[model samples]
Target: MINKKNQETLSHHLQKLEDISPKQLNKDQKDLIKKMLELLFNDPNTTTLEFENAYRVLIQRVKVGFTFDAAPSEAKNTISLLVKDEEKSFVNDPLKPHNQLIIGENYDALKNLLVIEGERESKVLTLFTM
Candidate 1:
């Protein structure tokens, strides 16, 4: 069981983490700090030494995760358009919009589909063949 003082310290650190501006830290940094705070908050066995180490890592901006060339780049929110290829299309209807095949990461595609299809009056049928 966590002592009352430790609980208060955890609460104070969590509040401090939350108070940090989004612009000041990249998404990965924010995620790392948030996860660390969550672990500290949820774990009853968390020690003062662990908390000190975590804070030291955060304050010093020590490299934690795998570094890549794209790590520094911000993720872009983009809407992907599904356009039908006439040459490869087996069937075509003049009255209806052409059926499209979207090839890319599913998460971003789902987000785009949700945004675009949500605007339509009719329900959209989504199929994931893969």
Candidate 2:
């Protein structure tokens, strides 16, 4: 829970935050402002550590954009392995890596590719969308 002195400080900052247009502030700043207001009005008993954790989570969500159910990190970690069809071949060239055709949800495919890329020592990614 916040002490009287800290509450005063938060109130002062919140006042200053309200004066600025939200567009002028970055995402982190905006999330901070939202959390600050919530803390001041809704959950006064929330501890500083808890407030900080919630603030960090808000910032993370902003960074990851839209997601459903689990957080992005958790979603990424749980990505299933890409299924390879050795029988299907575009070219018989044994010297070159074969192009893959992935069939799945767009976000899931992209996240799975990212996880695969991260495991390698060198990564080069190129995307073409139509």
Q: Which candidate has the top score in lDDT?
A: 1
Model 2 Cα RMSD, Å? 15.9
lDDT of 1 at 54: 74
In angstroms, the error of model 2 at 88 is: 32
lDDT of 1 by residue, 1-130 (tens): 6678777887777676667655555667767887877687567676777876777677455334433453554357645687657887665678887876767757665776677678552443333322
Question: Tens digits of per-residue lDDT for model 2 on 1-130?
Answer: 4578666756665565556554455657776666765754457676666655655554454456643464445553355978767787356588866776667668766877777778652433323221
**Segments of candidate 1 deviating more than 4 angstroms:** 26-28, 62-130
What are the clashing pairs of model 2? Answer: none
How big is the positional error of residue 37 in model 1, measured in Å on the Cα after superposition? 2.6
For model 2, the superposed segments whose C-alpha errors exceed 4 Å read 8-42, 66-130
After the best TM-score superposition of candidate 2, give how far the Cα of residue 54 lies from its true spot, in angstroms. Answer: 0.6
Q: TM per model?
A: 0.38, 0.27
Model 1 residue 70 distance off true place after TM-score fit, in angstroms: 16
